[model samples]
Target: MSNGDEEGVLRVLVVITRGERGGAQVHVRDLLVGLQGRAALHLAVGEEGFLADEARTIGVPVHPIPALQREVAPRRDAAATRALLALARRIRPHLVHTHSTKAGLLGRLVARRLHLPAIHTAHSWSFSDGISWRRKAFAIPLEAAAGRWTDRFIAVSAADREVGLRYRVADDARVVVVHNGVADTSLRARPDRPGVPVLVMVARLAAPKDPLLLLQALEQVRAPCRLRLVGDGPDRGAVEDAVARLGIEDRVELLGTRRDIDAILADAQVGVLVSRQEGFPLVVLEAMRAGLPVVASDVGGVSEAVEHERTGLLVPRGDGEALRAALERLSADPGLRAAMGRAGRSAYEARFTVQRMVEGTAEVYADVARRHGLPALRRPQTPGRP
Candidate 1:
């Protein structure tokens, strides 16, 4: 491992497969922001999208790896490995921290070749529950192979850590759970309104994230409620068609990709995320930070953040009737919504604050640096303290 900067600040090369706006992208962006000033950060990412834009805006050096794509192409994979190795050579980072599956595989390989410590944050394993059998078959062995090259694995949720062990991706001692976090938005209190309740679901209209399931459940909601779908993906057209076919177009609004999520949640009554799978979604924490009760599918570490009947309701994945009941119950009772929202906000402050996530990650970096014989990373100063 290269000795860090002269001042001893760890030079970390963060890698991720895509720069697209999604859970993994958001996690990377937030981690970069929180690590600012505490470390010398560089990003090697594929595609130019929100993650790249945000990293540049925050003044982190962003390296574009054209061959680093999500799909499995042997030629491109080989090229991406060469390009990443070259970049790692040039940057001479003390450690390489990778996110997502593709980057994790390639980044760790590069780190191993260079004899540098590698830390991989598994946003969600491809073989986790709710994924297709074919995908699981492909992923299990690949992850097990990559696990040997990884120095430490950071699973965003304990559930994800368990999956890693169950699949033999890593031993229990190597994987640690560091829950995702977001900036607090609790000050943007939900407004007290009298019109029909509005339920906001902020997830990409894509597979795994079943926006149509929420739409289907919304149709069964007896109470008059408007559903706002706040994301865009390949399934947008299908969701639009579902909104029309369900004949609830008038009750649903497709607000595709908005930056002002806190504002939107402030104006709404409840926040919802119905997905086939997840790995401690940041949006759930975002909702909790905004003091809005959440109704999410009970999958992949969501239960760690959302306490049933306290912070919000958790229904079985794909169960339209249960989903509808949860939505209806929250919609009809304003008092319950307000109470749950308060509890959610409290939970966010206690466990899901951005500071906690950043600190946890920094500690992991320090540990890896020490094990690799690198100098200790300077601790990040608390935001408000003198």
Candidate 2:
């Protein structure tokens, strides 16, 4: 704060490849907005995506790199790295901040090449979840190499930090855990109360999300209940097929990608997430904020969010039996569900607000600046920032 590095100019460039409506992208948007007036800020995201669109809407200078995409394309990825490096050269950023797996690797390497300090936030580990062993083989080693050059690694959950340390991706001294944060989304009255309780899951319909496991659990439910999936992705067709195969078509509704999530949550009695891997997910928080008890997989930072037999139940990854039992338990007991919902809301207010996320991340930024001897930190330009 008040030392050797207080008088120099410091600029931050936040980079991400996929800017679609995932947790990582949401984190970037919120971080930039929260960090407003704290430092000179810029964002480099995939060209013409939701992340860029929203960042621009919030008045951040956005540099779109077409080559920066989610799919692994060697030529396109190299081009994106070059684009980022060239942008870094022009901006002369004091620090390079990266999110997600691919951008962290490429951007951190670029930062090191230019002799600049770099900070990476592990939205989730690249090799995490249930990817093929072959993919994991290369990803783990490559990420370890990337971690070597990263000055500081911010883990979104304790689970992620452990993953890095376990893999020797980075030393414990260099890794810090900062739980993701959520804002108070506007609530709407839910009057569509079905006689049979409804379960809602808001996540992309992808393999990692494991929406299929949720369907299998529904088939095992003794009591009648309905499931509403509020998002869509590559696995949409498969998910639909599973619902048909399980003969739960009448009970399951696929309300593909929704903008009115709070409203949707307002209607549902319980929320579930069956992702095989995750960081601290924003969707879980959204469900908690809406006063809905969550039944989610106990992988990654999920245990950090939902307390077993407290706020909500945490099932083992891909365990349809455990998932079924938990869902049935919640659905059968309205009073217990309400109690869990109240507890979840209390937890959300206590530890998971956007204010905490912003201030915590600011401390990380200050830490980086101090360690780099870059500049004496300044009070935020704006008197009040949430």
Candidate 3:
């Protein structure tokens, strides 16, 4: 249990479903960097993938549990719980912190049974109004059930917190709002390109993302411009179909999973997100960091990410006409885009930073460890004085 120096240190365990290089995974990875050497960090991951390799490169211990499934399956859930329980017994961690829905539910359930303090971060709600009624009903109860097992529920946005309370999942006392933070140094403004405007949308091409909405809205746009869709997902085909059907395929570029997101943001004049719902999107933060104005749908914690007419514009969720108008306004007025982009960069610096995020998460770990009577204190990993 003691992975630190002679001095007593905290032994913290952070559990996650998968450690892929996505928004949630990247956030946790950054937090771990700040916690390294300060705590005995053990990452319990589900099935090996991109995250497993990344964690190992950082010298963090990783435990793989394949039983964790994205879908709701009684048999798999039970097996995942058993696997988690066994891992907990062996690690005997002072605090158990989990991210994502599947890992959060199963990890907290096992932690509660073992009489350990547990915390979960709701990166985004899986039960947004955008999904089918059947899916929402199933997710609400499951999420509500898991809330009872968690000692604290960390939400990335006030909207998500409101949803939790509305559904009777977690009370105000147990819920904490920790806005998503990204390093402000990452922002780089792109030089203006002559001719048509360039609008960018970065997100996993999943169902909830609704990239097709942007494509449809493009038909209504009067200004000449190109829409760059970044990120990959199962819904790529649907998006392509919509673009082709709308005869805007030439204007739409499907740039799947590009490494130059910052570069792309710098060259772009505007950023857009038409998701059914969002939980403080990191892409928006990245866009702000790049000093690119945003035009996102009003859903979930999206309002928190974008300030109407100031940092960026907010359109009604799924409203194509409003979206088209917003894009046109930005495209037509270069001055307006520059002003909004400047405001967005300022917001990013004031509210979002990797250091702030790591510090907040560390505080949570310390609190959970104290409540559960786990070992506290880890040697500082800074180069000068270990």
**Mind sharing the TM-score for model 1?**
0.96
Winner on TM-score between 1 and 2 is 1
**Candidate 2 lDDT tens digits, 89-186:** 98777899999888888899899899888899988787766556788788899888888888898999999898888778889998988899887866
Question: What's the ranking of the predictions by TM-score, best on top?
Answer: 1, 2, 3
Across 157-268, the per-residue lDDT of candidate 3 in tens digits comes to 8888888888888898988888888755544775244678899998888867888888888888988888999888889888888888999877889999887787888888
Give the clashing residue pairs of candidate 3, or none: 9-376, 9-377, 9-378, 10-377, 19-51, 187-289, 190-266
TM-score of each: 0.96, 0.93, 0.92
lDDT by residue (tens digit), candidate 1, 51-78: 9999888878899999999999999999
Clashing pairs in 2: 5-375, 5-376, 6-375, 6-376
User: Which 10 residues in a row give candidate 1 its minimum summed lDDT?
Assistant: 1-10
lDDT for residue 291 in candidate 3, whole number 0-100: 88
lDDT minimum window of 10 residues, candidate 3: 377-386
